[model samples]
Target: MDTHTGRRRTDTDAADRPADPAFERRLLAQVERLIAERGSVLAAQGRSLADLGDVEEFAERMVAALPTRHPYDESLGPFYDTAGLVTWLGVSRQAVADRVRRGTLLACRTADGHLLYPSLQFGRDGQVRPGVFEAVGEFTRRGVDGWAVALWLTTASEAFEGHSAVDFLVLHRSSAAAVQRVVEVATADAQSWVA
Candidate 1:
């Protein structure tokens, strides 16, 4: 039962739904590919399969050795390339580059070194949200990578009563104090690891 809505929750609700078999198959395939790639890399480094000890232990170590994927990688996005940003913002490509250089816009760099900006930073008016630049500045100053900052902004947080910073900004545009508080807390937490 959903007390807030005064309605009975149904199994049809997304949260209660079962995983899609096709998605599960894709995930398993990716895991297999990852293990194979890792094994090949190990062989090239002069460590054969025999050196990996037991097969179960080899699988465990290979999985653990895989690099963490960015959280946003799973999302279907309106991610902006440099050309897309130039058109969307009604600005030149150089202007977009300048904003990135100034840390006024957060962009993730691909392994190929191209920048992609998530569309969530833009308001309905197509302008950058007021506190976004400041928040990005704070995170970058504290040495947080762009992907980590993007993940933090999109994730719901109990610290803000379960609203993600981006959602909080959309709902409370007149003030970004909530988002600012989240940024400060993230910066402090990052600093603690170094200390």
Candidate 2:
């Protein structure tokens, strides 16, 4: 039974439903939430969902546009699988996803469709750095992918004076100025990347 629409869901509802109903439902919900959230801003900017045209083509193009993985990827990980993150943070899997959605944690989907969080993001204290939340939130808000966000945080940036964001963040973890710098540069970088 469907409470929101007062209509029961039936197998015949759509011939195009994917094989995994649960995964499909979760993904659909995420997309709907994003669309609803971004719809107004996109409209004001003279854009519409139709601008994406074909979903498959859009996905392929987005994938193609991502920054290439550099050698830094190996240093960025010791990634935490969902189960390990759940045990480490004492949070449920859904809670983990919620945090990722909120941009307070970094997660990138593996090729097999599982989310993995880098151990480096939490440092040794089991807490996400202050600047990280703001930077990632800005990046994701600008329509950048999570993989790109992770890469941006790890890759060396000449703008940061030959230091990666993670390095600068660690060196000045408690500095408000540094955090603001991260947020500013992150949004700028995200804009250029999307453009």
Candidate 3:
């Protein structure tokens, strides 16, 4: 019931009150028509909203549509280069060149081209003890992300056994200090994920 209009209104009409039914219907019809028209246009262009099922496809399309060097297309953090680092570290390479290229790790090549990293530098190329990797792998198996593993290893001051070598650094050091080193290396190894 509309007090001002002094007429009974349907529930749907009342829900859309203050809006004329004819106008509302026309507006909705127009919107639907527009959607259909646009959908057809997109289909003609070999694309459609229907094809975008999961977020991955949508994101892929968005990325594919991006022009070169767009800031939005770039990764924003230190761990962005983790894949390469993990590979190099696994291969027993010093990985200084890789880290330097990423610009997130810091080190100087010695006269003989040997890389020098401070003992406390987390991302610096160092031998990953077997137990350390096991500890990290345990954390990962338990659904821990890199941040959590790094946090526990660097902050908790506890020895862990896992398949990822990250735990070794944490086991031998206080978590706080280890975390600090991780931060330093992240900054120094910019874009280098290996460290």
Candidate 4:
């Protein structure tokens, strides 16, 4: 038979039901105790469910943590020149020597009249590039080492018609040193050849 609560009577109902009112009260008390001892059962679900509800909270806390843009230091690197350092600096053949005399720029001349300067020390504006303080935090956070970077400035054959180190910037600092040494040797050789 169906009771007013809509529960169906079964053969075991009489046996399963607590005979004493106190026993029924005790069972109810135990259930209430369990509910109190544990947290809301929904809290025990997977992290994904928690994450879905926490998205707005997480965004509120972390929206400012994301960066807005990349700085210019991320784009600068070691660049090279062709047709000698004089031509690269847009100066006459004698201008590099003049700068050397004036103590404005450093230049090591080769025997064949070729001059080499440290291109990395100068920026596109003929002035030293600023240090990376503005973007150093982001650059360091992303683990970028500017030493290994290179920017190749190309020149047409007509501009540098018969140059040796055209269209390539040897980025490796050690490689630049090696090239400078070669220029030193060539300067000595040229001095000897002229003598």
Candidate 5:
């Protein structure tokens, strides 16, 4: 409820609210600038940015493709904070931090810079789903930020048979080829970031 108005908060209100129009554009502009700067550095080293492949189109498509319906879109969350997760997992705070730092656990930083573990990382048993550590490590190893990794994993892909990577991992846990395919896609995504 909104204390001042004595009314409940609803999805309708959220949908009615105006989103920040310039945020995505600003981010796109920053990425474009980064690509240009990278191109400059590569040129100095006798290389070309052409290898990145249609950088502008790639950036715009990614931004446009961002999922618009997640609960996170409404709130930046109470998403599995470390202290709470430690209780649930029966581990010390240091262990959780270590896992996140090592990329064995997926975590994204809030605007205020606290790491919040996405709820998707946990299964119904309160354990992390299999193959998560490997996938998270793959992205982090190649400079893909945690938030982007989380988004990529959640997005439905035709490559994963119209399912997200998480579902594919769960359903194909025993298939070595399937697991390897996930890793390969992660590597490809990393290559995009490397561009």
Candidate 6:
């Protein structure tokens, strides 16, 4: 209500809306870069834009194929801070830090210098799965960063018969050798690119 004018106020003014030109510009730039990159990769593989059949389908696939990276400041998260982890694992904050230091847990540091642990490492029983730590150790040994390791654990890989490393781990909890194979194969491919 507009008490000063003695009249009821309604949301009819367009000027009340906030401007978002910066966000729009950033989104436009990212989309343009993705399209250009995807086009080049497709061309290299003998699959032209025409082979996509439809523009919308191609856009969908391109989005799906986009690499998953850590968004440092955004609220969209499956991440847990120290306090949350303490509660979740029924352990002290120091214990969490110790686990991270020992490479028994996977953690990503945010721009604010806070460590955020990926929720995927915990099972339904609130315990860190055994294979996750082993995979993290292997990734660390092969020079993979924590973010890439987290993404590799979650993302579907052809090496695992189209199943993600985490999925295979959950399905075959006792088979550490299978997870080791996936890690070795991925690490070797990454190294070959470096060579």
Q: Considering only N, C-alpha and C atoms within 3 Å, which residue pairs clash in candidate 1?
A: none
lDDT of 4 by residue, 68-90 (tens): 11122234322222233333344
Q: Model 2 misses residue 163 by how many Å?
A: 0.3
TM-score of each: 0.55, 0.59, 0.23, 0.23, 0.57, 0.52
Question: 87-110 in candidate 3: lDDT tens per residue?
Answer: 334432345455444433333333
Write model 1 residue lDDT over 38-74, tens digit each, in one string: 7899989988657757876444433322222223546
lDDT of model 4, residue 178: 38
Tens-digit lDDT string for candidate 5 (98-124): 887787888887676766677766765
lDDT of 6 by residue, 1-195 (tens): 422212233555334457689987998899899777978999999897687678764454333222122343232236665555555465777898887777778887766676777777777666667667676766665566667777777777787778777777777773768767766765665566346
Ten consecutive residues with minimal summed lDDT in candidate 5? 61-70
**Which candidate comes out best when scored by TM-score?**
2
Q: lDDT (0-100) at residue 154 of candidate 4? A: 21
Give the Å error, residue 151, model 3.
Answer: 0.4
**Regions of model 5 farther than 4 Å from truth:** 1-78
Q: lDDT ranking from best to worst?
A: 2, 5, 1, 6, 3, 4
For model 2, the superposed segments whose C-alpha errors exceed 4 Å read 1-75
**What is the Cα-based TM-score of model 2?**
0.59
What TM-score would candidate 4 get against the native? 0.23
Q: Against the unseen true structure, what C-alpha lDDT does each candidate score?
A: 0.64, 0.69, 0.40, 0.36, 0.68, 0.64
Q: What is the lDDT of residue 79 in candidate 2?
A: 63
Question: Candidate 4: which stretches are off by over 4 Å?
Answer: 1-84, 109-113, 128-195
TM-score of 5: 0.57
